[model samples]
Target: MKKAAPVKESGLGMMPANSNSWNIETHEQFLLSELLPLVIGYAKGNRHPSSAAALASFITLSTVLQSEGFTRNSLIASIDASRMDIHNAPEVLQ
Candidate 1:
């Protein structure tokens, strides 16, 4: 059997140095397409399908929740920025 190539790095990064920068990269495809199969094939030593499926589901759900939280925070920050703009508007423009 041919050995499959190792998966590429996910390019995960720490927070941006610039406070105003938001450069998030997502890897749902990598998780579903690559990691999921690997886990199902080799997880728990016995490679039980039920065990693998359960673990994969948990991981996928956790990742999705984290992503949702990030999106929610971004929206809140945007709203705050809009409020600042309103407060800073010239009296004539108000």
Candidate 2:
């Protein structure tokens, strides 16, 4: 039988040279730093509805993920896998 592939470790891939560890504070800081810029850019692009809806969804998912102790990498991987599965599925399944 063929062996299964090893799973990748989750969370942010790697820390910056200056950063020591990944913790709650680091997660919050990263979220704020990254998301604020995205929000601003979306707003500037006049995609208010899309930006607001996405931000709301992101906030909800972030809260749920935090409560469930999920890492960003795992979340992204899961979403990507789901999208691929859907895309490759037959029309009846979709």
Give all TM-scores, in the order shown. 0.27, 0.33
For all candidates in order, the CA lDDT equals 0.53, 0.59
* Candidate 1 wrong stretches, greater than 4 Å: 1-13, 16-28, 51-53, 56-94
What is the C-alpha lDDT profile of model 2 across 37-88, one tens digit per residue?
Answer: 6767677688576668577768776756655568887666656655776657
Candidate 1's residue-wise lDDT over 5-85, tens digit each?
A: 322333233333564233222555676788767777666567576676776666665555455454556445544655776
**Residue 27 shift from truth in candidate 2, angstroms:** 28
- lDDT leader: 2
What value does the lDDT take at residue 66 in candidate 2?
59
Supply the TM-score for candidate 1.
0.27
Candidate 2, residue 18: Cα displacement in angstroms equals 44
Best by TM-score: 2
Give the Å shift of residue 47 in candidate 1: 3.6
User: What lDDT score is found at residue 39 in candidate 2?
Assistant: 65
